[model samples]
Target chain A: MTNLLKNLATTEVLGINRRNQDYLRPLNSPSAKKIADSKLLTKRILRRSNIQTPELFKVIRTEKQLKYVDWSSLPKSFVIKPNQGSRGRGILIVYGKKKGSEQAWIQSNNQIVRIKDFESHIMQIFEGRFSLGSRRDIALIEERLKTDKLLKKYSYKGVPDIRIIVYNSIPLMAMTRLPTKESNGKANLHAGAICVGIDIGSGITINGIHLKSKSLLSDTYEPIEMTYDQKINLPIKGIEIPNWDEILEIAVKCQRESGLGYAGVDIAIDRDKGPMVFELNARPGLGIQVTNNAGLRFRLERVAGIKVKNTKHAVRIAKNLFGGSVSEEIELLSGRQIANLVEKITLFEKGKYKVKRKRKKLKQGTLLVKGLLDTGLLTSRIDRDTAAKLGFIDAIKSFNSYEIPKVFNSFEEAQAYIDKMDNTISKHEDIVRLAKITEEGKIRVRPVISVNLLIKGIHKNIEVIISTRKELIYPILIGRRELKDFLIDASKTFTR
Target chain B: MILPNLPHGIIVLLLFLPVIATIANFARYVLGIRTLGIYPALSLAFAFLLTGFRYGMIITTLVFAISSLSYSLIKYTRMHYVSKITVIYTANAIFLILAFTLFTQAPFFSNVLNLDFNEINPAGVLLIAVLIDFFVKQTVKKDWFTATRSFIETIIVSSIGFLIIRIPRFDLILVKYAWIIPLLIIVNVIIGQGSNLKLLEILRFKQIIVKPNPQDDKSS
Candidate 1:
């Protein structure tokens, strides 16, 4: 119990009471805070500096003005945000207009919102239903961002945005907020979206936290076991974020421009446009500390009173101070030391079944497979011919015996067929279809198998995705999920 | 420590201190520090009842004017903010003493101000000076612009509180029914829960709330 208290003390998670006494009250100025609190003013200030934000379409200030709004003339996909909105409140996301109906628009949840309901929503916004203190607030209609293609799989319905904490014009820490099925397409940490911590320098994800539990998500996509309860881990960490340098630059500039000594910059990466600043918070919530598994007080104290020349200098200082530490922590947490992108692996079976090689200088089943580490692929993939040589044909036959429903097959027939099959057949019926585009731009969903393979003298149970490597040079591709224990070096061709 | 032989006015004033302190603390905790301005204004009204209106008005005005005026001088100084503030407070104290002596003793000043020195309570003057100094200290810690803005906001909030406390019938009723204090507590608690947005944000954001449909408004 004492140990737990000591750990909690060390974690430096700032509670609301302490945050008010220490961070917010001291650092934040009332005038700059006023700017952050009002989205319209914030946008105006940012736009004057030529910072790119979502394009604003219209704003409804008064009841008369709200009544005068032509709902039909609005874009099919746009966002209605309250000027003084708090958290993720007062933002209505219209996914698109319902087919052939001008009055009906589909919301993020795919609910068909009628024109009357939409107008009433606007009126409610005008009445300050969503704004801070429930005061009357103007609704800002703006362009909704399209989710980046690489991030689409991680998000449920809404766009994934990065929330960066910038203190003294330095991008101190960052978290990538992904909308979960439970969050109802809202990228709010409190609303159940996963907050994955990003290494400030490398932009690689290090740790993730389920906001409510404050539990750490492990390297292998499992939540670290805690005393009270355990949570099912979502695979979030280790993948490198696209446009890392640009994102950090914007966050630092946002703090400097906003006149806020301490600020939280919410940036969303659009598919074509790159990183765009959507919101700024003077009193950014303390949930970021838990997500990063690092105390904000330490980071804030480190940067306090230090003269920052410009945003570029701040970014460089931040990288030097806060970066590289997460990579070391990742090594400790996963029990896997850092490896380069390319590594050499000796592929050998437990015992020799038969000889099927051109070079029979040594034992029959022994082969040296040059492996290239691919973090993008979740499962380790191997050429189909290699699997045949490795005597995995029997396993492949058993894997194929499980009945899979064809695209045009009826649900009832598939269910009936599954019902008629034995428990063993039904148990292994889970289908994972992983699609990837080839070098020639052909999309192929490869066949997968859960097999025991030997790589670098360690026997690992890995799901191997089978693909025809007729045109490929290397026969084996080691994915991130199986590389937890091994570090790869691209320079070394075949090092055990 | 209850002295039954004490005068009614002293006892009432003693009881008022704790209740007023509680109210000030409530304002600080729930509504943020900027709302601390309301306390001195409310205190002015009570001071009027306790030590007469003339003395209370004089102290309030003296504090507000001195604090607001100090901003212009403080801006150009290179001294540390704490040292600067201490200098301002010392100047305010000297000015108050000079003003009091001139108002009472000097025939020219006495004629211009037209006030009776005998009616002013020394305790009320001391209380007002301390409260205003504290308010100034809080306001001036911020940047010049924010300090000025909050300083004005504090005065506005105080004036509103003073006005509410000065209602002739309400003042009498409040003194008679101290039970209303608990009701005010409940009201404040509810307001604390509700006032999550800054008042400035509501006003500033109104500029961007444009009318979307010109034809619909013209028809109306």
Candidate 2:
């Protein structure tokens, strides 16, 4: 009991309540919500920005419209839904018109529905039976999405779709709702469907959790162990969603165009059309936290109020900062952590003062340098004369036995060196190997030395090639290969 | 002029707080005003107006003090929520009966304390008792410290409203033009529509508005 309580207190469990109280209620204005909750409005807004939505066959706004509707002209497979419906209620999926009966249709659950049934359903919709608070509503018949081959296995019969919770234009979390026999062919979790959490960065499903049987008492209530059926196990995780980039792009676009600060964007991949957004919900349920096995509050809080320029920028920030397992994989493969483009590095000089340069020695030095970290360079570099003064001459000489190159303080001097070198070193293999082009177009055979650096209290051993400081403003330059543990922030300069 | 001895001015002003509070509660319901420690201020004001400030203050203070004390003690006793609330209210009822008896007889200076058992309306006491019970029960649902803080805040808000209604000039204006009371509805509507950001949200999102120098947009 105590353990369950403790887990409930964790951010993942409490995030739902916190997000509702803070983010959803505050960020999503009531007017913005009208746009999301109404399917017609959502489609109109999303369509304006070129975001694809399932084609609308017809909208039955009145009982008279329902009576006059040409039943035979409707698509072989279409979805009938109430404009203000929620939790998959008031949704009737017609697989196809029953064999020879022109008015009869077969639902995903295998229930036969005649034209009269659809009329009654549309009448109920007009009467607001399934609308929010049972207010009057319209009914829409949309083209039913053909489930992608990869997703068909997880669902029982109904087509599963991706639900992404977007906050502040950032897609925070995603999950796929799979239909189950227990749910009567509906992909609604409360009806016993399985919800599979998907990693936002990788687009791969992570874990599965089902809604527990509601028949049990409160004290006995617990989410049941997920199983494929009464016997076999379903492989719910590791399902790779195709066109995940498009899915994320459309979800963010929906949020941006809807003018909702927080939104839940539902998208489905059609067999041929790729991804199409189906709905946008302003007050999206927090069941996604349980489905994702991660908290939404922290991710939403992390991205809140940060200015995002476009969908790409928002998606990149979300993936890089809160990408979950994908980031861990990158760190594992690179054998290093990712950092910013600029970093602070402390440069070490003499004990008190020494024009010291030795081949090898154990020395403690001081001289903090704000190094401009660049990944383009193959090796780290520093000013030649400054390196020699810092006692790196011996180490450099021992590494390659190269004599000190003449220091050029001006661009003209470096340009002069490049002209002279073009005649000699440009033609010879060994000479060319010894010389490398600088940012200023000059060439030099600078020696390399391994030095210790202390950045933000982390000690690092980096090998820097010696170069002339004449053209560069920064004396020390740290390259990508040398930056392993440190995260560079280009916005930040040297802090000592 | 029709009822000169009735002190119609004070009576009309006494009605102002409840009317304003009713409008405020309606605003709370429709617009979702979630600022803390403000909901029951009107009931407290009504309680104070029905009985003089001293008696009203005594009942509110005693109910809150006793109920909150019992609430904190009963929390560790392993009872269900309904049963625990029952225990706190029962303790409060017993304390109220005992305190009322003691206040009527204890002659510190009779002039200062206006409470008399014979004149005290049982219905008024019951209403105050119920409000106290609800105030404690609702606030304690969150946490002990919150319950205690809200109890004090509720009383403080009621006392301020009570003092405002007592002002002579304000009382005269309300009685002279009872039609002016409808203006409060318009005032509340404007107040609700004007500010979308709550008091706390303004402070919370202050950093977004007071931006630093525009040089570093990339770094967090």
Candidate 3:
């Protein structure tokens, strides 16, 4: 407990309560909070000053508008928003017109949206289901921006928005939010979007902090350096966000125009229109601190009373004073790589021989003493002895029935041995698949069983090829499926 | 130590208010328990204090079951928010009063020591009924698990308040010392300006705290 307190104090991470009381309450006026609470109000305030915002299509405040509105007259692609929704609630995205349907559109998940769906959704808005403090709110439709070309490759389904924290017209900290498929394309951190910290000066993305995608570790969040798909080639780090300066300028303009002393401005880039202001938040989340691995309190305190000449001047001052080390940020982002050749890995097995329907499953198995992080291999391999020890005795029992050939066997011989098995052999609950391997100058047939890997509290279900590796040192070998999470480094002790 | 001028109700209510607030703060910051804000918890605690323990539990449980049923029935209706809540609360109130009538007349009650329905304050009953609003809103917006968790936490915190008030002469002690009420204001300020990480948030921001994972780097 003492260690937790000392580390937290040293990090100077601000809590939600403190953010509201000390910074938001004292700094922001009640009228400013009122403006920030309503998206339409903030957009109107900014659009009056000629700042770029998504053009509003329509507003629905009553059932009359919701019922009589022409669905066909609407654009093929647009977004529905509750004017006072918090944390991206009561927001719906229509992808495009469905095939052969006059009044229906497709959603991000390919669900059909018709007049009835639209009516009920807007009815909820009228009922104040998603509004702040359960007050009745107006619903609006705005043009949906396509994910920019540079960021499209990193995001899964929707556009990625950058959240900038501005104080006294100067941008202090920023983080890019990517909409993953798991988040239903909302880009809400609570809804499972990827949040990566961005350097205020360079606009280069650092590490991303997102919820682990496994249900077994449902409430656990971890730092990641890869895209949602865990694609190695599409790394999340070091990607230059397009239109950095314009986004910062627009954020500053929004903060100044909205009359918010300290504000959070969300800006998303359109593939064609460039950076456009999405919305403004009066009291933003403190997750940016964890993403940046820096304390917001320290940064806010450092420039609390400084004077700025103009928007450009404020941006310049921020770049000079509050900017972090760009090189260190890049290195730190890349450090999620598990660098060791042989590392300890935990495997989870079924507690019972046959898991009944809806039963408590996955008794965590004994930690594999040593696992080889073999990058050259495409699929993970586990020695037969280790697999049996990890509760895959059924696969070993079936393998033992096959007679052992003394002579060096060929690939066809191993394939023939697997092909001769009866239908019951493939029905083993532990066995995921079968694979043919050429090892030690001969052919080896192994069963690929499903196993859960728990590394640094990140849970993943990976297939391991059960092989006879009694002579080998390491019992298990992890392959390139998740090899991106690990990196080869010279020394294990790379203290930040 | 009883004050001669003030009614016992007001005096006890005043004493219990600060204790309930302190309990709520302790629950929120130190234990990381979230209830339906603080107002619902405060009133519910007072109601529990007025009705005693077993009766309080019975009434709260009845409210939870009846209010949820009423909400599920009225949610899809074409009524406005205020009217829908009014309908649900009316249904709850009808059943609550009917249950009291049955309990007062039941033959088994006399064997266990009969409960006097007239003794329970009408204000206390109204206070407990206000929790139905939180339940309806939670069901409308959030999932059952979250709504149920908040309700349970609220009940637990209120029960703590009731238990504190139940202690022999707990109110007399407060009446003897009048400074404790204003002193609680300082406690609230400290809680508001608190710098340390909350117990729940420590786990939430675990990514920020650098863990020196003594790496055993021996590889053959």
Candidate 4:
């Protein structure tokens, strides 16, 4: 059955994934590229655009500056980072107040980093050890924003931020990345953070939950029919994001400024500040697909040819076109109503179809047949009681002749009697070794039978085992291996 | 019996060696400690552990002096960055050749040059080449003070790298679980996002701000 499912099943449901790099590769925009590749330029552009980012206190262009700066002037809760640093390399986050005149403490993984340790760390950063391409870089210390209350429970200790993918000035998708204890208080999935996709129309997260175990309600679940439970459904359903319109405008303006057609805007909602633009990403992760559980290929294709006039119109189109439609589509694709229902089977013999009718009509009595074709089964099998009633009693006598023990009781004895004769007459080989035998219900019989089968349509002959307890829904169990050629239209009613 | 596979062990070693070199380079460049390039700084530390610190420092200084002279002479003619690095690397190789000559002819330096050259350990030579390359590049790019500062940063970074590599506990953990790479990448991202200050800018900001220049006064 496993083999058959592997061969027959279509992978259409699994097609939607977050890491679909190929689909997003062509939509790479210029603005996103500039922001990701050049940090200095990004800071300059953001500052010029009136976007609130971490203040760049100073820049060190030459060695002269290295000799002159007073290290004591640095603030307590400041962060130091490299300009060309990609991923999260070469960054130092300092926290806590000064205890003594010379020594200041830093908070890292709930531990205190002394001032000496901090200075050494800064020196490492200055050396370009964390810089991209191993080029020399300037490190700047800026104020760290205090995180808001709504995200406090979701995040460990780091600042939780929102990632919005903007394409052609349209905010296509958004997700809030939260820090976890596992992530060591860093709100990066690669750093152990979990990503929760946000519904664009409603500020409520589409798929996000506190990392606690519970039986999820039916309506809140995504990809409705998918049996696997992975993503968390956010509690808030339709709260409008604070600066939705402004965010859209910023995205459009950034697109125009950076000259990139597709980009991702990272925005942090500070407790004091409303929505501060953090940084721009040129190559955004495809993991957002898994967060949303929808393919980007379809969305990208839909927007590719459209002429986007303004940010408002683009947002309208994105909301009207995609919105929650992808989620619905995913639900439909994974629902259980479409799955196939097939049973396992074992075949024992090969034979031509022969029809026999009673020649004369007599008093009504149950007329049993020795050879009964279980067409529902992939392999031929016989019922013991029916075989005995049909006068195949000698079949049971021949069981001992094949060196097989007569281990059956009164009821199984009759059934085995019929099975043995059918095996002898049909030239069927019993290859299945009996592992265990037990009575299921009122039926007293050998439940398992081993048989060699030659399927009618296909040329391959196979050995299999069968259980006859299931006589109501299916008289025969056809394992998946036997159903190689014929396609089963599960949606259609069985013909025979 | 629980040791890592040969290929994986080799890969770990390869990764660890470069990281040690990089860290040493970083320390020397930033912290202002003097060490023979990233490789030599780390290698010397290792050599110090095997031989005594006095013996290790003596061998390191002798090799560095010879390699520096060869590198400076090679730099008399201008070359591209790649070519310059290549020249410095070749000079280090020549230094190794000279070491053998000194070992055979002069018994005084023989004790310091007791390492087997026939073994031709590329990792060791690569380390020396890295140190020489770093030293030569710094000397050429900036004045002596900047070069010296960078040298310090290199030493700090290399020492950290060397210590990380040498620690049996860390080595065992890293070897057993390679998932640390992703974790490192995440940490890198967080650092990238959190940091706003450039270390060099902090180091230089005071001088640039404190002294009002004559040219600026004239312009004003």
Candidate 5:
């Protein structure tokens, strides 16, 4: 229980209760929710603001309108949904009129939806079964926008939408909800769609999670490389979403126009219409955080008090803080652990580092210490205190008794000191390798011992020079020699 | 501490509802298990209280079974929604009556005559009325699978509620201090105060939670 709470704090995982009390209830105004509840009202608001959204074809508010409506004049493809539907419920996508039947249409699921089926569905919507609190609602029909080819290839039959969670006009975190066969042509995580995390700086997708309908418990989601379709064997990992900057701009603008302090704006790409705003959720789903492998609380706390001039500036600020795919790329490809410049790593005792034991297997005592991923040095180094704690007592005692000079003013002086002490200190049985070192104007022979270290999640058996860099703050310094698997990004500090 | 002849169990129902609803809420918010709803569970529990557990359970099971059966039989027919609901309810009455008759006549259930269906108080009738409201909605809106799922969840919650009501210690304490009912606001306040992480969400967001934390080791 304590570990769970610690992990929650470490990752800053936001729960439903916390999200509602902290974010939604405080950040979202009642009017914002009022508009969000009514799809027609949201569309009108977004359209009036000149934000791009799918055009509204017709709205069936009364039974009389349904009776008098001309069925043939409707567009070839359109979407009919309840004005107050939640979680993508009570939505019907019509591909076109069915062959040889004027009153019939082909649905996204390839089922023939006749006029009777359509009317009955509208009547059901009017019956208030789909709306929250089961209140009576009208049906809003919008022109069905085709998924751009990039997203179309990934979807089975449904259109995909990118949800950008904007807080204080800054697009903080984003994930694209890709429709799957399991989702039944609906792009909802609960309905079994895949959520792929997108880099806030560049709209490139990273790792994703899929909640298959069989695993409806919401806790049991599978990490996925690609969508459910076997036809498209390509992974959806690095697909760059088109119009990403524009999408962010519009999403932030939508939040601004709606007077919502925090909101999730759904954007779908049409082959012609470009990126169109689909829906604005006053309370966005918390699953996006899991998809992004980021905690909303952590991100929210970051941009809480920052001021932005406009949507453009906010997008830039968001990109600058949360962008970059360095560690994400490594994780996506190989599932290797990600580390920052400074990290806490686990180190084991000297002989227990990685030595093979023929018998008498014993547990190695481990200690947590700070490490620096320095790019300048070729060989990694550990301090004397850290070495002694890791059972390198003999090596530390031997090096300490050598009476090494404290400071060498000249290069020749340091080289002479190193040449004199080489054979004596180098002959130590514990010293695995010898390496020259020059720092400031001082040069000293440091013992390189092989130590077992756990960085991020990867375990390494690497040689490190033992030195008392009393001036340095970190007990350990990891050089380029041990950082072969990771890419260094100076902008990032700590990754959890 | 016993009540002074409160007519119908509504007053008693009111007194006990806060505790039962909070239990349902805790099951939902903390444990991530959901019942049909809080009100329905409360009604079922009170119904169980007045009618006695054994007969109440049997009748509840029959009501759900008959509700499912009647809806399936008439669903394909060209009948209006209201008419369909009325027909299913009529079928429910007939089935319950027939089951009661069989229970009275069967040698195995010869003592069922003492189950006291006739002596049921007005509270029992009101509780059944509330339970029937869900039945009516199920017939109009839900399929057999979802209706059955809700029925089972409701039964589980109602059973817990029934057990709470059966405990005489709580009844004595609560009836003597009936003002304790309003004190559920404190419980509601504690529960309503969101923002603290929910227990179930810890498992739901396990990935984020368990993600390794790299200390902000800013040392050189």
Candidate 6:
């Protein structure tokens, strides 16, 4: 098992990671330049660049702002997010105003959260408990992006954002992060959002595209009703980004200013404003390799040591090397074969049997004995009734039965019979000698003899005091002493 | 056949004394305490363990008083970084000469401090060398406060280095788990990556503040 674990660690579950790193390392420059992370820096950069973002109604930075800011000023549709939060931990999106008062209603799962509850939730953000690294943070309220009609049927009350991996000033790959009910309306994959890679030149989605009929409002709880018929496709294919050239230019300028060789630029399109530079990332996630289903090591290695005089040259080089489109690569790599459902489980039992048959055969006439394998625990236990049932009735009678104490004393002398079936029983000693037999309208029986039992698997043996326990569900408890040989894999199932 | 190996033991003890003296001086002078002129204090302590306390203390006091008076006159002039270090060594040599002269003159001390000029000990010279190196580092740097801070850090680091060198048990364990060095490097890298928090303007939220007038701030 240890050898298996060592082998598993070395096995390549995914090949794209090694390729991506190889491609990125050469373009990466080591410099100490601070570019604000997405949540803080993107908002500032967008406003400076004259790009329209969600309207910020109010910011609660201090206790004064928290006290004076009017709740009534907030629109029915708004989003409250922590300014310094990451992985979408503290974001609340309000879908509509409640029936009574000026209170807002938030969609959490299938339920509606009241305005007071939402404010209390914001208090968690104010304390910075959910902030990145648990540092202090301020919360901001902004205008929520209305879910587009096309994507409305596919999502709950969540907004989707596009992530563009820009390396050395060129946009290499792009993906649309979609929020599912599973994602709790957050567009962060770490927060359960599904990442669907999109073509850079074209806006078509590559994987996990859901084409559903009903509007998002109707069935809030169920999975989006995907037909699997009229294949779900991204609507904006071949339609160039509103400001593609400008976005690329901003990425190049930002890279030069920040001195970061590799980066990711997140851009969102505002209904009124075209394309806004959302944020720039220094150490971008390697999951983009999985999204593109291409190895980054190969791409990174190809660009290594290649000097680019300008952004135009960099873009040309990137396009010439990694371009040609991913759809063809995906088809060629996967080979037109549908994925197999059965391949999900690699380990299978040889023969199939009904669940009922397996349970009955184990419980039928076998004597149940509970022992503590605890290298630490010093005892093993057995019930008298179980021993009698396992053809020990004659032995019990010769030892003097009816009463608990007499039966216990008689079984000590009969240790020779118990030793024949199992060799490890050393000796029988003092009986527990119970004063009274109390049963709630049930038959009471006691086992005689405290026996020393040796476990088959572990290094140590335990001397357990045996007694009948009728209420135990499993009828036997294997203590820690017996469990030394195996390391628990929390991901596996355990059955007796 | 085993002849007690007197020469080898003497050689090892000779090598060990300088390291012990420098460590003691580092703890006392740099960390701001007091100790006798480097060698006599270390030698007296070792001798007190070998001989009786009354005899060792008498010789130690006579030697320390003479060296302190000689070292006082040596600190008169300002010099360059390397020259300053030379001054410290010159001061120690003069102190050693004064101690030898005073010990020979004292009737009680001369009988107890029985050692020839040939046995004058290179370990004391090595200890003075360490002190000179430290003195040079402290005087040469432009930032006095930073230099002093580094001096304190050096003392602390060398103390740890000394303890690791002296203790065999700790040395063996560190040798066994040499892989810890690479693991520590990886941990430092992860810490470096995690601490980076990007600027607000780069994060793209635009509505937080109004534009600041740069001219007004400059004039004020």
Using lDDT as the measure, name the better of candidate 2 and candidate 6: 2
Greater-DockQ candidate between 4 and 5:
5
> Cα miss at B59, model 3 (Å)?
5.1
TM-score of each: 0.49, 0.54, 0.67, 0.42, 0.71, 0.40
Candidate 1 is graded, for docking, as incorrect
lDDT of 5 by residue, A172-243 (tens): 889998888877878887667888999887789987898643322334677899776646656989888999
Lowest lDDT 10-mer window, candidate 1 chain A? Answer: A214-223
Write one digit per residue (lDDT tens) for candidate 2, span A1-496. 3443333333223233355667677889888999988999989988898889999999989877878999889889999999988778779899998898887899977889888778777876776656676578899999998888888766777778899989888898898888888877777776777888777866888667775443211111133345466244557766788888778888889998998888889988888888998888888876676555455555665677889999898887776555545434455666655444555566665333332345334345666556677767767887766676667655444534423355555556656655655454333321221334464554444444556675554566666766755777677777767666654445323232
Give the lDDT ranking, best first.
5, 3, 2, 1, 4, 6
Q: Per-residue CA lDDT of candidate 4, range A366-411, in tens?
A: 2312222223444433344433333333443333356433344555
> Candidate 3 regions off by >4 Å?
A8-11, A64-68, A212-220, A228-234, A329-496, B1-6, B29-32, B54-126, B139-146, B189-199, B206-220
| Number of the top TM-score candidate | 5
Worst 10 residues of 3 chain B by lDDT: B211-220
Q: How many steric overlaps does candidate 2 have?
A: 4
A50 Cα displacement, candidate 5 (Å)? 1.6
Model 6 residue A232 lDDT score:
52
The DockQ figures for the candidates are 0.02, 0.02, 0.14, 0.01, 0.29, 0.01
Q: Is the docking of candidate 5 incorrect, acceptable, medium or high quality?
A: acceptable
lDDT of 6 by residue, A194-303 (tens): 56655543345554332222221110111221322123523322223445455555556555555567767666555555555545565566455445444343454445
Which sequence of candidate numbers ranks them by TM-score, best first? 5, 3, 2, 1, 4, 6
Encode model 1's per-residue lDDT on B60-164: one tens digit a residue.
677767866775677445444445567777778888888788788988757776776667677766656666555554444333344444545444444444455
A414 Cα displacement, candidate 6 (Å): 99
Q: Indicate the docking level reached by candidate 4.
A: incorrect
In model 3, residue pairs whose N, Cα or C atoms come closer than 3 Å (at least 3 residues apart or on different chains), thus clashing, are A338-A486
lDDT of 3 by residue, B48-68 (tens): 877777777778999988988
TM-score of the second chain of model 6 compared to its true counterpart? 0.36
